[model samples]
Target: MLDYKVRTYEEAIEVIKEIGFLPLTQLVPNYPSLDSITSKEHWHTGSELDPWLWRAIFPGDGVAAYGKFVKKKSVLISSELLPLTRSTLGSPRSVNERYQDGLMSREAVELYTLISENEGIDTRVLRVQAGMKDKDMKKPFDNGLLELQGFMDIVVSGTKAKTNEAGEKNGWSSTSFETMDYWAEKNKIGKATIKVDKAKMKLKDHFTSFCSPETMKAIYKIFKF
Candidate 1:
């Protein structure tokens, strides 16, 4: 259990660095969550200290990486552990190669290609660009996004506000996507030569510091490693 509660954006960043990663919400058994650690009063207040706001800001600020890495659930990962996690969870084959091998869906490959080519694109715009704008395409588009994230191929880099032709902002902001390679380069996280087995071991040991045995088992089950 965390001895101190996280009450500020800076504190939350420090926690992620110290713990290696923190789920956006409670996920794995006994895992700490941003919601659980933070003071309740500041949530959804649109304040700088709000954890919800941090989710939309951390990646853009290079403070931490935001993605669906933990059991395919959203989490904030420290820069130090980001590459290791990628190496452990990601496929050794290229996206195209995986698609050719029938390991990935065509929709996922299309999304990956677009995300890698662009600096960063919001999902709302990305859907239209990928011809998934219709309501029926929502599930496939969403699934493809998650598939890329599961492979550590892309990440949530920032959030963008919706705008009208008149240049006025509309509705809530949408999460922006970018290739993991782009995010790593921007953050100065070098791709290392760690083997998959070693990388998994390292991450498991890091989590062992704070997780109970039951939690560790749950992680292994969820991650399938």
Candidate 2:
């Protein structure tokens, strides 16, 4: 459990770094979350203390990597732990190799290519660019995005507000996606090829300090670590 209720975004960042992993909401029983530790009153208030704001701003800043990582839910992982986490959860094969091997759908590969070619591409423009703007293509577009995020191939780097033709903000902000390799490179994270077995073992060992046996079980089951 958190030592105290988190009241600020800075504290939240420290918690993420200390825990190494945190979902936006509690997906596993007794698992820590920004939601569980923060006050609801402060949420969605467009303030510096808001946890919702932190999700978009904290990533790609040399502190954490954010994406739909755990159970394909929004999650934050410390930059220090990202390499191990990626090695454990992400496929060793390249996107092209996975597609050629029949492990990835064509739509997913296309989306990945678009994101790879243009870093920090938001889903709004991505859909139109990839010709997935039609309602019928929604599922495929969503699935492809989720697939890339689940494998740590892409991460939420930031957000962009929707602007009207008059140059005024309109709707809620659109999230910006970045290729993980590009993020790591820009962050100066060294490339490491850790064996999955070793990576999993290390991750579990790190979690033992804060996670209960049942929580660990749930983590392993959900993340398939």
Candidate 2 runs further than 4 Å off: 223-225
Model 2 whole-model lDDT (C-alpha atoms): 0.86
Scored by Cα lDDT, where does model 1 land? Answer: 0.84
lDDT of each: 0.84, 0.86
The true-versus-predicted C-alpha distance at residue 51 of model 1, in Å, is 1.0
Clashing pairs in 2: none
Tens digit per residue, CA lDDT, model 2, 15-116: 888888888998777878889999999899998888899888888566888999877799888888998899988888999898998888899899999999
lDDT of 1 by residue, 1-225 (tens): 555588878888788788877788888667788888988898888888778889978898887789886566898878898877778778778999999989889999999988887769888878999999999999999999999988888889988988889989988889899988888898898774588888888888787777788888977775456
Pick the lDDT winner: 2
RMSD of each: 1.5, 1.3
